[model samples]
Structure formats: structure tokens, C-alpha cells
Target: MELAVFLLRLLVGILAFPVYLLHFLGFWSNICKKLFPPSMVVFSAIYNHQTSSKKREHFTNLQKFAGPSGKLSLLELGCGTGANFKFYPPGCRVTCVDPNPNFEKFLIKSVAESRHLQFERFVVAPGEDMHQVADGSVDVVVTTTVLCSVKDQEQVIKEVRRVLRPGGAFCFWEHVIAKPSTWTYFWQQVFHPLWFLLFGGCNLTRESWKTIEQAGFSQLQLQHVQTSPILGLVRPHIIGYAVK
Candidate 1:
């Protein structure tokens, strides 16, 4: 049993590396967009609609944190499919960066038809190494459901700080550690080995928000929604803003 388990783990790790490489090169992202474009559209629509109570409350919080949009320079790290582009205020110069070239293509397709949006660039690399983005160039940085998969969470936060101007806003929505159910943790721990193998290197137990705070972001405003505990195991659905 022990050797079998070890071999299984080895296989998972080996398979995960290729998934990560493909995702980094934008292959999986493009396939995902084509596979479920409607789901993507609906998800974006839910976030953009302030009338929904949850979205309204989140938007209100965002408004207090982000203030105005005129001349706002926005950066989204791990912007899969760039679905959130339409949610951000119009007129702000948006930049979406992801390691997946496939995701960049989907982003281009998603926004190609929209004339009102203005984006300065679409980057196909991880944000942790932003040699392409200039220092102190961004006004707002957003990360939605991206941190769980980032290989070097600490480095990414530091890069974000370096790129944002002083007093700039950083917004995030992510999953985190949960309690009241050891079962959730167990399943996550069990499935994680296979999950990462199949779906890029997305680990189930990445405490990214805590890492964000440690990376020098301050003036923090946060909101936590306790969902069905099982879903919280992998999708805690957290939202917050921090100032740089």
C-alpha cells in the first residue's frame, strides 16, 4: 500500500507539471473559454450587477476603497478570460496579465467587440515577474480567484506593491482556509493531489490573503461570506481591498 501510494503521488506530480506548463502557455484557458462561454458570461454578469444584494454590497465596499475611475490604471493578475474587464469602471485603462497565452487570446475575443473599454495591454506572463510593467504605474490591482494557483505568492505580492503607486488600491476575491468541518479539509487534502494534476497547479490550501497582508498592503477592508462549508473547502468566496 505504501509503495502504491508513493507511486500514485509521483504520477500526480509529474502530470501536474505539464498542466502547469500548458496553462502557463495559455492552452487550457482558451479551451475552457470555448467549452463554457455561457458560464463565463453569466459569472461576469453576476459580479457586474450591483442590484444583486451580494454584488451590491461588494460594489459599495469597492467604491469606498477605489473612489473614482478617471485616469485609473488597472491591473488584473491571473485574469482568466478577462471576464472582470466589463465590471470595472469604464474609462480606466485596464491591463490584464496571465501566464496563459490562451487566456490572453480569450480576453481579446471577449473584449474585441466592446468599444467602450480601453486597455493598455494584454500580458501573457505571471504577475510575480512583471519586468514588462513599469514601477508605480498602476492605480488599482485586482485578483479574482487567481491566488490559489500562483506558484510564488510572496513574490507576486511584492511585484504588485512595486507596480502600484502609493495609496493605490488592491482588490481580491479568493478562497481560504475554513473550519467547522474536518471533512472538507480531508477531501481537499485527498483530492488536491489529483486536482492539481488535472487542472494546473491549483492547490486547495493556499492562504493567499494572509500572504497579501504580509506583503505590505495596509488600510485593509475585508468581508467574509460563510457559504456551504463544503464549497468553502475549495471556494471560500472572500472579498476585500488593501491599499498600497
Candidate 2:
């Protein structure tokens, strides 16, 4: 049994060596920044197809924030490939923020395709520190599948609240940790390290909902739901909006 286990470990290590080497050499970051946008585009199409009804239900909440001109000023943190642009109401002004500068080119392409949305700017900043965006300036803040990868969820939520006007909304849909007793949670724990290393710092086991809940939003409405089964450990999701 010991020898068999040793051989299994050896085989796993050998298979994983190339990935580790890329990370060690800092090439993985650049590679992921370039490759992730296109991959997310494909994934977004499939994901949206599967969860269209749920997304529509959640996004409808945005309509409440439209100003007298019927347009809302929106900011999205970690806006990879602008996947959420299609969901915004027509004529909404959108500011995209992401830590990866490489995403700007693909984001611009997405902006061009989304004629309904007015492109404000793409700020190259992480969610934790979006100092470029003025405080209390945006009517709405959106983040989807973003908090799980951020270095500090609390700081990100703080920034979200800071950048929103009084009574403005903070909208989010994020995959989160499953219940402790579940097999999915076990797998999430097992896969977390490799997933973080390979997938732009995403944490499969992050309880992002907890961070949002404790952020002191004036009013919060959130729901826990399961998304596409193909998401595996990340199928558990929380979707909601909070008023600041």
C-alpha cells in the first residue's frame, strides 16, 4: 500500500510539474491574462444559456436604479471580457475595472460589440483598491464571480460601497463554498490550491456571501442557488443586490 501510494504521488507530481514551473517563472500570470478573456467569452455564452432565467431575474433589479434620463452610471469590478455588458439596460454608462491590463484589448472589443452601453473607461485596478473611481459617483456597482478571486474580499466590498452613491445598489453573483457536509465541499478543498494557481487566484472554497453580508449595506437581498451542474465544485452560487 505504501509503495502504491508513493507511485501515485510521484505520477501526480510529474504531471503537475509543468504547471508549477510556469507559475514559478511568472509566465503563468501573463499566459492566463491573455488566454482567460477568450475562454471566459465561450464560458459566458454557455453559462448564460444555462442560467438565463436566473440572470434575467437578478438583472431586472438594475432597472430600479435608472435616473430621470433612464440611464444608470455603472461600475463593474473585475470586469473580465465585459461578460455582463449585455445584461445592462440600454444607454447605461459603464466603467470597467480589472487588475489585468491585458484584458483591456478584449474588453474594448466587447465594448464595441455592445452598442447599447456607453463605455466610460477601463481602469486597470484591482477590486481591493479602485482609487481611480470617485467615491459616491456611480449609481450601481456590479460584480459577478469576482469576489472569490480578489485578494481581500472585505476591502473590495468597502470599495464597492465607497464608489456607490447614497442609496445606490451593489449587485453581485458569485460562486461560493458549499455546505460543510457535502461531497462538493470536500472536492473544493482538495482542488483549491491547484485551482488558485491555475485560474487567476480563484478560491473554490471562499465564503464570499459572508463578506458581503457583514459589509453593513443599508439593505440587502440575497439568495443562494445552484447553477449549471457542469460547474462542479463551483455550482453553488449567491446572487443579490444591496443598497448602500
Candidate 3:
């Protein structure tokens, strides 16, 4: 069994050599920036279809957080293709941040289609270093399925806290590692390297919920959910809000 597992992993590494070469030559990032958006659209469609009900359940209460101006300033990190735009409260102003500029066109198209949201602007920056966004400026900070791909989860959480106003909310729904005893966990551990290469740095086994909980949010309401088996290794998710 051990030898079989080792041979399977070796085969995966051999098949992933082209992508590894691209990374070694510093071309993988550019290629991913160009290709990932369109691929993400197809993935998003399937993923959103499976998770929409839970998303609606989590997002419907955002209106209660609106201030006296009756408008919530929302900043979304890693807002790829603006998939969550339709779930936001009507008339809420939304600023988007993403590292890949190639996603801007698709994101703009999504914004145009989402008439309920007021499109603020899109900043090309990673979640870890959103220096363009001001401190304590937004009523809410949101992230969905983003932390697993980020270079620094701790810094990104720190930045999330920095941008949120007093009493503001941080909403998140992210896939996490499966239980240690599961077959899914075994596969996730085995294929993580090849998966990371193919998916542009997304890890299969990040326990991102722990980072969110340790970020010192004044109040947190989080729940672990198991989604469709179609998601395979990434079927377990953590979803909820935390007040800063």
C-alpha cells in the first residue's frame, strides 16, 4: 500500500512537470492571471448552484448593519467575477479587491448584471496588502472561498480587521480541511502539491477557520457545514459573521 501510494504521487508529480516548469520560469503567474478568470466562471456556476441557499441564509441579515445613512460600505477581498454581488443587500456600495487584473472585465460584466449593488471601484491588490483601502472605512468586509489561495492568511485577517469600522461585520464562507480520519483527508494530503500547481496556489487542506477565530473578533457566530460531495476534498466549509 505504501509503495502504491508513493507511485501514485510520483505519477502526479510527473504529470505536473509542465506547470512546475512554468512556475520555475516565472510564467505561471501571468498565465494563471489570464486563464483563471474564465475557468473560475464555470467553477463558480457549479459552486454557487450548490451553495446558494446557504449563502442567502447567511447574507439576508446584512441590512441590519446599515448605518444612519442607510447605505453599507462593503469591501470584498478576492472578489473574483463578483459572484457574491447578487447576494448583497440592495443599494449597498461595494468596493472590490483582487490581485489579478485580468478578472476586471468579467467582474465588470458581473457588476453590470447585478443592478441591486452599487459598484464602487475595483482595486487590483491582494488580500494580504490592501493598502489602497483606508483604515476603519468600511461597514463590512467580506470574503468567500478566498483564504485557501492567499499567501498569508494571518496578514489577510489583520487587513480585514484594519479596514472594518467599529461594530462592523466581517462575513466569510470558506472551505476547510476535512476530518483527519476521512478518506477525503487522505486524498487531500496526497494530491495537495499537484492540486496547488493546477489551481494557482489554492491549498486543499488549509484550516482557515482557526485563523478567523484567533483574529480576536469581539463576537463571532461560525458554523461548520458539509456541502455537496461534488466538491470532493473541499466539501467541508466554515461560514458566518464576526464583529470587529
Candidate 4:
């Protein structure tokens, strides 16, 4: 009886290994969200070098919007885990809006570390509804890899325009819909359904450039880029700034 029980326990351990592994992965993924949102960390590192030039150009353009006070009132939509705190220019008074309250703690700590930035507020609202922000107030509206996942890209763009002061610029770096019939686009569609479930509602096939142009911005400048740093399915990006 003792020998039989030992064999059964060994078999049970073998059978449970995969389940335990999965639980361990899931737990770490959640922990990573608190430490640094996975989407921000993984994708930022992948596109960092490829996006360098465009980020500089767009940030330079946005610097013109700074007021006489020498500060830019920056409103960042989908600001996740304050991953962007390092990229912002000094004297960037930031107002962050995101649906996930889980990011609040990470954001607060980031704000404290960023002496160049002052935290205006953190609104627990999705980009689609930002009634709290007054019209024509902010000097810059920035979004990076954001619209691809927003529930209503159109409404969010409208909100961006409504909140920006006249002449304020909207800076964006986002992956867009790849050319049709390509191997990359094909796989994007194949994985579209599960893409959001795995990686925070990000879609690979959003026509992000067209959506921004139609958002009633007074001036739109975009550069559609093909970068090999990431998988082909997510390597096509549009990076530029639009003026309101």
C-alpha cells in the first residue's frame, strides 16, 4: 500500500507540472503590470532605436507649443505605468488619462522620480471620455501605440482636439495596418481575435494614420515607416505630429 501511494503521488506531480507553470507565468505577468506594464516595456524596447529619429523630430516640433512660462501642458492619453516619463521634456506638466487604476501606483512613483515633470492629475477614465479636461487647454497631446487598442479611435481623436489649445501639436508613434495580402497582414488578422486578450487590447490592423488625418487637425504631417526591429506583423508604423 505504501509503495502504491508513493507511485500515485509521483504521477500526480508530473500531471500538475504544466498547471503550476502556467499559474506561475500568470502571476508574474500581473506582477510585471505593477512594476511596469508589459506592453510599454516590451514594445518600447523593440521599437526604441527605430523610433529614435522620429521621436526627436516630433518632440522638437512640439517644443514650439510651450507657453511663455517655458512649460508645456502635456496631456497623455493611455499613459501606461508612466513608461513615458523619461522621454518627456523638462517642465512638462502632465495630465495622464487611462482606464486602468492598477497603473496609479507605478505612475505616482515615476512622477516622483521625474523631477522634470509635474503631475497635474491622473484621471481614471478611458481616452474616449475625458470630460474632465477643459477645451483648448493643453499645449501638447501625446499618444504612443495607443489608438490601436482604444475602443473608439474616432472619439479619442476628437477628445484630443477638443482638449488641445489652438496651435497645440499632437505627437504620435503607432503601428498601423500593414499592406493587404502581405504575409504580415495575414497573420495579423489570424491573431486579431486573441491579440487584445493577451496584450492589453492592442490591435495590429488599425488604419491609424487615416484616422488621425480625419480628426479635423489643421495640419497633419506623417511618415509611414517600415522597421525590421520587431516582428513583421507589428513593424509597420506611422510616426509624426499633427497641429490643432
What alpha-carbon RMSD in Å does predicted model 4 have with respect to the real structure? 9.5
- Model 3, C-alpha of 115: deviation from truth (Å): 0.9
Among these predictions, the greatest TM-score belongs to 3
Error of 1 at 63 (Å): 6.0
Model 3: how far residue 105 lies from native, Å: 0.2
TM-score of 1: 0.74
Q: Which pairs of residues clash in candidate 4, taking residues 3 or more apart in a chain or in different chains?
A: none
Residue-by-residue lDDT tens digits, candidate 2, 1-244: 4454456546655678887789889898888877877787788788888887888778877978865667799998889888788888888899999998878888888898999989999999998899999999899999999989999999999999999999899999999999886878766766666678768889998888889889999999999999989878789999999999
TM-scores across all candidates?
Answer: 0.74, 0.91, 0.95, 0.79
Query: What's the residue-level lDDT of 195 in candidate 3?
Result: 82
- What is candidate 1's lDDT per residue for 1-244, written digit by digit as tens? 4454466667766766776676678786666535443444555555445224544454343333343444667788987776665566656677888886655556777678555667778887887798899998888888876788788888888888898888887888776655435655555654576665454566776766678667767688777655443344564556888898
- Residue 137's lDDT within candidate 4 is 88
Worst 10 residues of 2 by lDDT: 1-10
TM-score between model 3 and native: 0.95
| Cand. 2 Cα-lDDT | 0.86
Q: Which has the higher TM-score value, candidate number 2 or candidate number 4?
A: 2
TM-score of candidate 4 versus the correct structure, residues matched by position: 0.79
lDDT of 4 by residue, 1-244 (tens): 4454456545654665654464457763454345446455566655656566656655665667886677889999988777677778877799999987787876787888899888899998989999999998899999988999899999999999999988888989888888886777766666554454446668988998889888888998889887665556788889888999
Identify the leading candidate in terms of lDDT: 3
The models' CA-based lDDT, in order, is: 0.68, 0.86, 0.89, 0.78
- Cα-lDDT of candidate 3: 0.89
Of candidates 4 and 2, the better by lDDT:
2
